[model samples]
Target: MGRRFEEIDWRETPIGAISLRRRLDPALDVDVYEVKLDDEYLMSSLFTVAEVELARLALAELPGADLDVAVGGLGLGHTAAAVLDDRRVRTLTVIEALDEVISWHRRGLLPLASRLTGDPRSRLVRGDFFAAVNDPTGLDPQAPGRRFDAVLVDIDHTPRHVLHPSHAAFYTAAGLHRLASRLRPGGVFALWSDDPPDDRFTGTLAEVFGTVRAHVVTFANHLTGGESANTVYVATHARPAGLA
Candidate 1:
């Protein structure tokens, strides 16, 4: 058996100190990978149903093949890997704020590192996701004002509870409009939230997109022996009345 607990990587980022750790879980008899920022747990390999669902549900909203996608966070690479699982996905650009987290994938520190980095379809870009959404050039720095078929985000805990005060604006209707501007017509935007469904946030999404859904994804919690839930908000950009 590998070391029971090993910190794979640790770095002090502008936001806070982040670390990756692996621990053998006796209950499941598997090594569990975890990520923590400061004292707060960010993500875990043990519970990734919702992160994978974030990519699945968003892509389901998209219509055509050869889809170009963008992922906001690169926590454990579960979400990004899920995006690439769809054979229809032609390209994936993951925007990560911390270079440290990106390095974890590039260095093969995380379990899904090779799956993500080795994929020719994936590009791990170091930049602020939220900032890029609002930029006139949009999410892809290489292609200015480039629009995507779908944009999946798992960065913040919730619309109301953000990692930083600056991120709170991205949850607002106006901020969503900025994000919509970065998508092709009929494009979809999906977000993962730790909080339960919020009616107010749903209303905000309705203001920007034609269709909005709040999916409550429940998964078995190994530690608690109970089911825990996460929310995924899927919003589709409405094309002009005459356009396809």
Candidate 2:
């Protein structure tokens, strides 16, 4: 039998707003927040296959190494939560542009976030991730480094389908170039897209990163309850020649 939707609560945030919805599935005993922009459903917490998979890919690419991870978005904290599961992570910095979303997590609206917030190794910054990345002042007092081991960006629905007009630049060639400069040697940059991106975005990644690969992860049929294919991008920078 399929699960049934239960109750939903609406909440406003400084960035925009979100709707917290509940499901009656005994297996999944929690509420999911749906990020909304002018009544449109932008992202949700119910199904986070792509979000979790992105973290897994980043960790896999940097095995046996203590990692300092920078996460761009904190929607329901699924991706951040997944990243925290890795024991190899030395520190995690989550930069969220929406103050209200941060407030929601602070007030216990998101269980995963609330749990992770208490961890000593995690730091949450309420600001624009782009500016934080580009700023050398260092957003976190504890993390005083120019580069991160992995940078996971989930700031938009996709590269082409940007929910916010300002986010458009982050996917462009120039925007990506700035992002690439923030990564440490051997660092990986991963992004989550609602679907596959256009050739321009992929081409730009190739131009900047040198080594790029895209992985498509399909959710379980029972979970989807329908047919859909989800994709995420994992691009890494190649060490310059003669650098070990």
Q: Pick the lDDT winner.
A: 1
Q: Where does candidate 1 stray beyond 4 Å?
A: none
TM-score per candidate, in order? Answer: 0.98, 0.85
What would you estimate as the lDDT of candidate 1?
0.94
Error of 1 at 106 (Å): 0.6
- lDDT for position 111 in model 2: 60
Clash pairs for candidate 1: none
On a 0 to 1 TM-score scale, where does candidate 1 land against the true structure? 0.98
Candidate 2 TM-score versus the reference: 0.85
Encode model 1's per-residue lDDT on 1-244: one tens digit a residue: 5899999888888889999999999999999999999999998999999999999999999887999999999999999999999999999999999999999889998889999999999999999999998888889999999999999999988898899999999999899999999889999999999999999999999999999999999999989989999999999999889986
User: lDDT values of the candidates?
Assistant: 0.94, 0.76
Give the total clashing residue pairs for model 2.
0
